[model samples]
Target chain A: MSEAARKGMKPKKNRAGLWGIYLALALIYIWAFSGMNLPEIKPTAGQITKSIFNGMFHPDWDYVSDPGGEDLLHGLLDTLAIAALGTFISAVLCVPFAFWAAANMSKGKAASGTGKFVLSFIRTFPELVMAIMFIKAVGPGSFAGVLALGLHSIGMLGKLFSEEVENMDLGPTEALMATGANRFQILWFAVIPQVITGFLSYTLYRFEINVRSAAVLGVIGAGGIGTPLIFALTSRDWNRVGIILLGIIVMVTVIDLISGYLRRKIV
Target chain B: MMNQPIKTSIPKPPSKIKNYVTLLLVLFLLWGSSIQTDSSLAELVAGFPNMMDLLNQMVPPNWGYFDNITDAMLETIRMAVIGTTFGAILAIPIALFSASNLIQNIWVFYPIRFILNLIRTVPDLLLASIFVAIFGLGSLPGILALMVFSIGLIAKLTYESIEAIDPGPLEAMEAVGANKIQLIVFGVIPQVAAHFISYVLYTFEINVRAAAVLGLVGAGGIGLFYNKTLGFLEYDKTSSIIIYTLVAVLAIDYISTKLREKLL
Candidate 1:
């Protein structure tokens, strides 16, 4: 509309518009920060910081090697076990459901929709919530954590597996069908071979995530490092908390390395 | 004469032995882990009745509890919004520094990556617990925890995307004598902006779900009510909270997914 615009002259940078956005964002930050009621930094804040640093450097050696009940090592093992078992169980159990959920594989639209809906429902609850519910059912322990992780993983694994199934090369299946193979025969010879690698990759990936989840499940008494973590924090035992945190970091790192290596090798 | 007897050596399908051994090893590990964790079919079967009872109790959720939880739910969303926005803001620098393509010096990117990995290993629950200790109880601790969590996530995702970006603009910018900051601003940001926003929204979706449970450790959110209701064995009330959280999470997920689809 302007002669300069019509002549293709450069327009001014919308400085006002840019500033308005910045101001709005700043206001939002202020509102949110105010809602938090952040505690004023007291002199004790310095002491707390110092203690945290000290604890980080000097973790409780006794607790780290303690062979007694529910020590860091035992907690680490339990967490690993939960993650491993949960991933395995979910990978095994998701196969049927995945087939049911895959539109190309399922009997009809209704079956696929129902399968997907069930999975969505399963996935709705956070792992912690599921852990709590499982704790209520099975009593708080690593077993409950495993159950929680497994049940929650089914939703994810099923979805991933179904996608794999849906996108699979139809060549093999069509070939087998043309040879008058039965449904189960075709599935065994065609579907499983194509999706096995993807299924394993997804399961391994899920295991890595589950390890992290299992580490924190104990906060809800579902059982893991999280219980000791909360205990130490509550009672102000920063040294033990430091050790637990360290163990978790090491465990996660090692698991990630191994899983990453395996995934690369397989996939 | 008949074609010289075709000597076809079928390459023996590479070692079924190896495959069998790997399968066995995996199975063994699974069995051992199942025993160690005390997770077995029998236990699950035994717990079926209790699970049924819990589900039975959860039906007919206490609708009245919705009024009480509205504020907490809003606080949770606000916490996620603030946490994710702050995290995304902070992540830009870290992601820039950590990206191997952006920072040619291995030393610079390596240490940044180590820090990112270390940060990511700490679960949000653990972060909240530590923050709650320092901040005293409230949504402040939850916000801080989510912020740290988001930083690790967004940075990791963003740096990976940054590494995969087209190098043409970056090289062109450099050839034009653009400074490091200028190159990033004009070249890098334009290329990665969509991906970065998508990562931020994805992280926000996770944060919303995570925020709902931060209250378990006194970090503040609907999880406080979750703890309270469950402590009182008020399954009906707990069910309502779960329902509300489900709705919020699903809505956020849907919107974020749509936004991401548009972006990419």
Candidate 2:
């Protein structure tokens, strides 16, 4: 049965068709450019270079230690607090939802499949889009930022949790069930041990991502450092901008170092 | 020979009251967070209609505005392509250094991992903003930001995959008197190259989306246009930009996913 079908199967003659599309697109581009009489880009590289040095390199030392410094510090604190709270909430909520969504933990396919579809939809939209929507409803603040971060984290954590569940060893679970343990007892004794380290690693990793996301949620008026950052940059306050950048770099580097250390110890 | 069962001590189970107390504590925390955040269920319900109203405003999107955004849209894709390529090239050495199996010294791997972690900690928007502050607002800063962002992403994934690879080929290379560089070239790179490209393309897809939004921070690309249009409350133009972005992202994601499936 297999040999007959294998002989009958002919590779589709679609290779030329693919190249035909590419050629067509190239021609269209050329034609469009000629018709439009596209203007040549003559950007002044020297001007850009001068501006970079003036605005970026010659950072305002006075601003770094003055009112700009105070504003930047407050922004930094706000960003960190929101990120921390969001990560904590998401980790707590996502653990139980992940268990229900994971194939190995749920009793049947229906429950797991439904849980997964909901999470998938949540993941399809970016955090910015969610923040925009929440800001419209809740008004711009750290609360909206937290909600956006938490929802997005749920999707990420759920997927990671399912993977951890899928790759777990089944031997201990069978042994625990053989001892006449209830569902909860079996899960606690068998499943949690294998997945605890993985769960911790995933949470730490998400925390790193959350810190980054929270820093920018302010662009949409969801609150945090982004508001002040946008203000300083647009105002051409190079000194304040430099201070903000410095603060962000320091904070992110520290979070990275601590999370990295913890992850290594756990794993 | 004496055969005796090996026995391990098992602790007593926690009482039911303990479980209930833990549950109560969790509930308390949830309530506390909700109160602090002022997330009332009543507010959410009341706000549902506003969401519907916003959606209503966005519907029947102005298709004509698509033409206006075409150039910015193409630039965004171009930025992503260049950025992803640059990042992937840099990721190779960083990933090699970070892989536990490849780097025998704990010191080297730990430090390399620390750098990767730090790079990954900053969101694409924040990175773009910082770069813009340094480089001045333009496509160059956008590209640089995306390049750094993609490097962090690809290095993390590639190194994790590398650590999980079969060590047999590496052992054989070492047995053949290969130096460290030669051993990696012969033993490690080939096995992980396809997966590496898969990660690169996946990161490229993300970079495309991220680049589209970088303009919001004045870094460069289509996002600047987004900010401009949305600033004036030009919902029609905003809708057009969003539609174009969604279509481009979906198309790239489809192709990338297919390629990744084939490579892996």
Choose the strongest candidate by DockQ.
1
Runs with alpha carbons beyond 4 Å of true place in candidate 2? A1-70, A92-100, A104-115, A165-201, A260-267, B1-49, B59-74, B90-119, B131-138, B155-192, B219-225, B232-251
Off by over 4 Å in 1: A1-43, B1-11
Compared with the true structure, what per-residue lDDT tens digits does model 1 show for residues A198-254? 999999999999999999998889877788888888898889888888999999999
True contacts kept of 2: 0.18
* Model 1 Cα lDDT, one tens digit per residue, B90-175: 99999999999888999999999999999999999889988888877888788889999999999999999999999998898899
User: Candidate 1 vs. truth: CA RMSD?
Assistant: 3.5
TM-score of chain A of 1: 0.86
| Candidate 2: tens digits of C-alpha lDDT, residues B66-157 | 88888888878878877887899999999999998877899999998888876776678877876675566678778889999999999999
Q: Kindly report the docking quality category of candidate 1.
A: medium
Which ten contiguous residues of candidate 2 chain B have the minimum total lDDT?
A: B29-38
lDDT of each: 0.90, 0.78
